[model samples]
Target chain A: MNAGQQTTRRLVSRTGPSICRSCLDTLSRQPYSTAAAAAIQTEPQEALPITPPTPSPSYALHAGILVSRPPLLTRPPHPFESAYHLYQKRLNERLALPFTRYFYIKKNTPGDLEWKRKIKQRLTPARDIGRYRGYGDEAWNDEVLVGAQESEMAWQVERLLEDAERDGGEEEGKKGEGVQTVGGPKKLEREPVERPMPRVTEADEKGDVRSLGRLLQRSLYLVVKNKEGEWVFPQDRLIGKESLHNAAERVLVQSGGYNMNTWVVGNVPVGHYQHDFVPEHLAKSANPTELGLKTFFMKVRIMAGQADLKSNKLGLTDFKWLAKEEVQKTVDEKYWRSIKNMLAER
Target chain B: MALRELPSRAASAVLHNSRPAVLALRPSGRRNASSEALRDVESSSSFEVPFVSDSLVKAFDPIERSKRRRLGKKPLPPSRYQFRPPKYYRGPLHPHQPPPSSDPVSREFIPGPFASPRLEQTYQSTIASDLMTLTYHHLPPGYRAPVQLQRLREWTGDSPYFKGRPLRPPRGGGGLRLLDPPRNFKNIPEITKVVVHSMVPEAQDNSAHLHVAGMIVQAITNVRAVTHKARHNVVGWGLREGKYVSVTADVEREDTFHFLSKLIDVVLPRIKEWKGVAGTTGDSSGNITFGLTPDVVAMFPEIEVNYDSYPPKMIPGCHITIQTTATNDRDARFLLQSVGLPFYGKLVD
Candidate 1:
């Protein structure tokens, strides 16, 4: 038998000892699957055929399936581990490049192979949130963990694959620049199997990964509803009067508590209105004339009492009551004049 | 004796009067001249019979020798006091008088009511009523002082207060203190639909973009003038003419930035400058004047002016004029008086 057929037979026998396909084939032994071996032999035969199939326009349809089926699955990683996991996924998604190859390989060298095992050991379960800290802590375990668990292990694996691809790409680039192929009988020939991948600098990578969370927060607000209609925060959250003193202080805090520079607060009222605290003017028994007449008013003891009523909590601003005696002392000159003029004309 | 006394007084006067005539005669010819006139007219003794004093009477006498002189000259009359004209009165004169007003029955009087309590109260209350009921200001005095607020890293500790400070004198003393400075109105870009509307039939026109742009230019200039006077940026303004109305302002700062940026980037391109405005509502310039206060608006031919501080109704503020032209009709004359020209080109390198 030829060397190729013998090599295939040996590989097939070593690969888990399962043999169902074409047992008598000359090239069945290989590290690769039996199907792979068959495809490789069939490829050459197909390229040089004595009687080829008719060249139909429908060839495009036949080629589509072959082009789409790649070894790598591009579906995103699951996103439900933890908030940090989600954050990392989003970051990666934002930085995803359109074209480039990154892959993992088994290391056989002492320096790389041993270091890979050590790195894997370092990715243990994270015992605490803040404990895990590093540029790539999200993918690997931070200091709190010594070994990766669950999805994190997958992240580590993915990161290692990327690193390997980048290292290979760079090495290929250096080798590519130093050599050139010549077209002559005296020149040695080498097959062009692979070319160097594109370079992605750190800055360009960061730009791709950058996100704007604050911008999104400001641009859109959630609109949740119930049977009653639109939702309103409980009085405590909305007004925060009973819970706070110095109304302005409450305002400052609720408005996103001040940041180092500008307040990040939103939905602030333009000005304070007294109506929130005071009874509606229409509901009061006092005549408009009597209330209107008072020149100076004193806050009634009862008004203070009313201010505490969980139901009637004073609104945005305070309101004082006009004393009965003071209200009587006041007069509406316009009213009297209009009445007098009407009587005189009649 | 009385007659003799009269003659004595008269004779001295007569001698005094004749003194000047005697002096007038030549010293050498005086006796001859006097004798000739006296002798010709009367006896010398008769001339002498004036006062009983012989010496005085002699001064008045005419001599017989004067008769010869009389042939050439008339006799001089005896010296007498010069006739005195009547003395004039100096002080003010009074007409006939009447009795004082204390006579009661004769004096005229005006009778009416005096200081009624009701009237006084009405007046007091009217004066007490304030025109404006609401006002806002910083508290604890000098609230704008830099020391009051803590600094921020991004902030340079610059004057946020400077935004509201007046750029010029206020319209009136104790008038509307501009709490905010003038601001550019938001320019809406991509004006696919241009609508020109006016209260007056004359203002009707199809080229709304031209009218609005011209109005904006005019409004900005007017605001600049008032702003220069009041020393304020036109913080906000509303323009209304009949049913046609527009409001401009930086309601919020971030929104304002977006507005100004969009206007510069988008709306400015569509503006047509040279097109004649449609509708007769405005004069040739397309300026429609409005009032700031109700009272002020009353002065205009149109609009009802009422001075109601509560929800200020009609007040003269600024007039807006819109001038429009087609984009293809661009020329140097299309630009009106504005705070700045609407620049439409690549930013200078």
Candidate 2:
């Protein structure tokens, strides 16, 4: 027997008889063997011609290296997808749609009162008798040829009488509440009766209450009277290759007659309104697009100038510097609903 | 005083005072008084003393006495006043006195030395002829030579790509070979677009905050941003379908180049404790996506200007995806390196 087999037999006898000799012999030989001993054992084993066991298919090799191939290279779908395609899709969807450009003209409080007076005088011709005609030849010509008509003179006389009657009624009301009407010394001795004051209108309250003295009170949105006399905000068709805000500024300068240098415009739109393009007449002149017009409104603050808008020069007859309440009442329901939040009182 | 002359002076003073009273008795005094007053008033008013003083009137003595002591001194000559121009006045006093020059004087034209050396016409013509002949000979056989080149000597220029050196095609039939260093990589590869995206949790989705995020993106990129909605619902993550969970702004062309320059020159340097973008940050495609902290996003000058509008607590972190027109990550990395963005780590296979 070999040395390993003899040692295995000794170990097996020491431990127990039933233990397998081959397992013991293999463990002992593998642990104690050096490179030289391993070489010697391999030579002898080769000489004896004991065949080696075959490897499993899982551990198969070809050409002394692993036989597995790399997965076939493929392109991912994402990198080929581009933002330009998405942009084109969005553009196609919005084709043939009309866009509205909205601009707000800032108002000067003091100038607004003068503008309102001028508007009132223009509206009521009969009450503007003392209005300045002109100077020199103009005044002479106006005096001679454009004298007040009989109807206007009669209306003026009627207005004077109405004014006198109102003054007289106010005096009578004051006198009725006075001690003279009661005709008693006791009434004079007693504390003055707390007279119920007249209920003030919104205009009266605005005149009485002082604002916080902020330089800017409210911004004025440019509005033009349409042919039907309905008040509509100044709007222009958005041109190609122009942003909505830029288009609004251009429209304000060209049509609204606002100086571009004096106004400070915000970049982002404050609000937007979308309405169907349904004109009253189905004439060819009217727009016949199926899509609605989407209007983007941006806020602009006036930096300088009197904020006097020249409406007549741009084919608009009249304009008014309206407050939030007046704007709501003047604009259409759909427009008011979209812009009310932007014009809401802070 | 001479006694007699003094008596005569007193007598003359009395006579001078009495004469004016005596004259008042006649109509001449009244006429002269009215006329003198009118002339004097007009004269005085026309030449009014700007600074009037009572002391000046008391100080003046107009009449001379005939006494010996007074006779030595001649009577002060009547003070004459005439208006003259200010002492410092250098030109005409009246506005219309000096008329504007009718003729505008032309400024002399002093031409500076020629900025560059003037080469001889012969030299330029020779070079031009040589260039024409060179190009003509090098032209493909099917193309006809121009008439100017027919008069020049035959000359064929070397290939522009190889300069004067002999043409050396890439070596080893299928192996790689280095070529001349390109001045610009624009033809081979380029940045296609820069996309800025930020995801908001479903529970944290607020339209106002999202709007502010969109505004920030717009401010940073100078391009309008669009809201991205969730495509699929993940019930476990509380995500719902069609819900807005992120915003993105895709910048291209000039804006993409501008953003890249700003990221390299400004934003990246401001990031604290930053190493570099990892080499493995890109996918199989050449698009690279990297996460940025909220503070790092705020470092962009556009957002810094209007930072108050978006409070710090509301500023969310975002991911920036840089897409390049390259086939693979290695090429994309080379492109980014050319633009000054450093990459870290050895690239994984």
Interface RMSD, prediction 2 = 39.5
Best by lDDT: 2
- Give the alpha-carbon lDDT of every model: 0.28, 0.49
- Report the lDDT of model 2 for residue B90: 47
Model 1 lDDT tens row, B1-349? 8887998889989988878766667445335632666555554553132446555445542333345567777667866865332233233453323333333222231111111222122212221111001111112221222232222223234789756554543345553321221111121111111122222111223235334323332232221111111222233532223333333321121222232233333433344451222222323322221112223223332121112211223222332232322121121112211112242333121
True contacts kept of each: 0.00, 0.00
DockQ of each: 0.00, 0.01
lDDT accuracy of residue B244 in candidate 1: 30
Residue B77, model 1: Cα distance from true site in angstroms: 99
TM-score of each: 0.13, 0.26
lDDT of 2 at B55: 73
Where is the poorest 10-residue window by lDDT in model 2 chain A?
Answer: A59-68
lDDT of 1 by residue, A1-346 (tens): 6566665654454443234233424234332444456557655544543444433211000000000001111122233333345334333332333211111222464434434443444322221222232345133322221122423535445444544333223333456654644642232233433433323335334542122111210111111111234221111222322221223233322321232122211111111211111236525734332222111111001101111112222122211122222122332334222222111010
Note each model's CA RMSD in angstroms: 58.4, 43.9
